[model samples]
Target: MNQFNRQHIGKRIAALRAAHGDSLRQAAARTGVSHTTVGRLEAGQFGTSLNSTLRKIAEGYGVTVEYLLTGRDPQHDFESSLRRLPPEERNRLYFASPVTRIRMLLQFLMAEYPAEFPLDRLAARLGMSPESLRRLVEGCDDRQFTPEEVRRLGEQLAKVTSIPLHWFLSGDSGELAAAIPPEMLGAYVRLIKKAAEAGVRPDLLEMAIDLLILKHREMPAGSQNGRRGG
Candidate 1:
């Protein structure tokens, strides 16, 4: 009913159509909607009141209306069970399997740099052949990269994209990582890692860093020694 729900439903419809190997025209024909209407729906321009239209589109894809609206297959009890777990436990389970990890990483990268990293460009950056990269991106969960290859790719990405190397490696703390520029992310990561290794509490370190920055800012103008009347 809201904008967010409309956009979410539109994206699900588009993804389902793509998965079914249907073009806009084909999907429109199947749903008995005009191609222009199908395009508008896919673009998230459809009003939320079009329940009949939504049902028709869902039927065209041979999927239930629930799946189209929620991006969940109603038949999958395992998925429902996973969502009921605690956040930490859910993340652990999600990333425990190598296939899931690979898929997550690919999805993350695609979402972050959709225009910048096409399959071939991303493959080249990772030092993988185009076909190999395509297979990995296309859900070849069994395809695994060596530790060394991952390290090399991470390092290269850190240098080139200004995204932190740890993001490429661990893929955690995305919001925090995104806030820091690539030029500073390496240093930020090193500082955090060093603090963690030394058993320093993160909150204490954050407070100390904030205070240090404030102190620097409050220093007298043109005072290199940061002392009064120096």
Candidate 2:
């Protein structure tokens, strides 16, 4: 709507939900997001949300998420798409449609390796075909999976990336601390929390820290001691 903002987008989501005759709790139940989060999205209080969350919201609102985000159907005008919308959201221009962050770690990791990558193993773990898994990580956003399925997806992705489950679930970077060995977890979390508070993109910060760790591990012992002392 006005100025492509989060607040306006939130207003749209609220309007669409109300027009659909679904209360916050009902929408949350149908969408698999918590009611509190649904309220936050309606209030424009959310930041870059996860794509899985958006898919659930799209299902709750009865529109393909692409049409919802850009106000135009993939195949036709916005009006034509509304012919497919659940009657209530037609021309309700105020639905919150902020751009969401598809889980980036999955894409990054998927590309980092050679072609011999173990897609089948990951797919078997998630109970999906490799094709379906590729489409999902590539941001097809075509379906609203159940919360349990989403959790399993997160768990599997977390294992592959060695990141925390919360990162996969919510896009929160603080979860990077969980990847640390238990002996260092408390200190790492606290330090990373401070870095996160500085308004850096926490994911990028995590990558930089990861590279530093690898470099540290590979350094000669004398140089490592010298650098540490310096």
Candidate 3:
């Protein structure tokens, strides 16, 4: 790409990183690139031949390579506007329980394109019977979706709604976790669960939990969070 295009891609990368709540180091780790490389990419200072690196970054962010290079994905404009919302509001919408967010997204698609997305037609498009789709949306016990079923739904949702497939499967939590080192994410989730069990106020603990994860990540592998090796 030319310098102008390179800079534009860099800006898109930065935006994607921010929207996913990832720092440069975290993004680098996730993409298997060095932290300095990620910093350089965000600053538009990459060498010629960035195609491989760009693909890796795009994969890390659960975005298409075209979206990263051209910012022209179907969801690009909508996701950009979402990123501009106050963090609290964005978090509330994105971090809602998976079922709730999926329902909200369905409602949004239905309302936004009522003529195009009537229930039976939408169900047919999803390769499901209308009653099955209804049960899925209504969370009926008889129609509970298996993980594979959810994955299939996510793929169809991505096609129809222009939302990322992960949004349908894991909501915002999956996006955030994708930005973190995979090895660390499990520990972070455990910590969050423990904090909740201990009666820590979730809103207040949010920042603390993130800080703790960052700190723990810096420790040598196999070391505990705070304890030093003998």
| Tens digit per residue, CA lDDT, model 1, 3-78 | 2477788889888888888898988888887778888888889855477788788667666565666665422433
The Cα local distance difference test for each model comes to 0.61, 0.56, 0.68
Give the per-residue lDDT digits (tens) of candidate 2, residues 88-205: 3322211111111223444543454323135675577567899887787776652456567777776764433334556445533333434444433444445556777987796787
| Evaluation by TM-score, superior candidate among 1 and 2 | 1
Model 3 misses residue 61 by how many Å? 20
| Superposition TM-score, candidate 2 onto the true structure | 0.32
- List TM-scores for all candidates, in order: 0.32, 0.32, 0.39
Best by TM-score: 3
Off by over 4 Å in 3: 1-89, 139-143, 172-230
lDDT of the structure predicted as candidate 1: 0.61
* Residue 119, candidate 3: alpha-carbon lDDT: 87
Off by over 4 Å in 1: 78-230
Clashing pairs in 2: 9-96, 12-94, 12-95, 13-95, 13-96
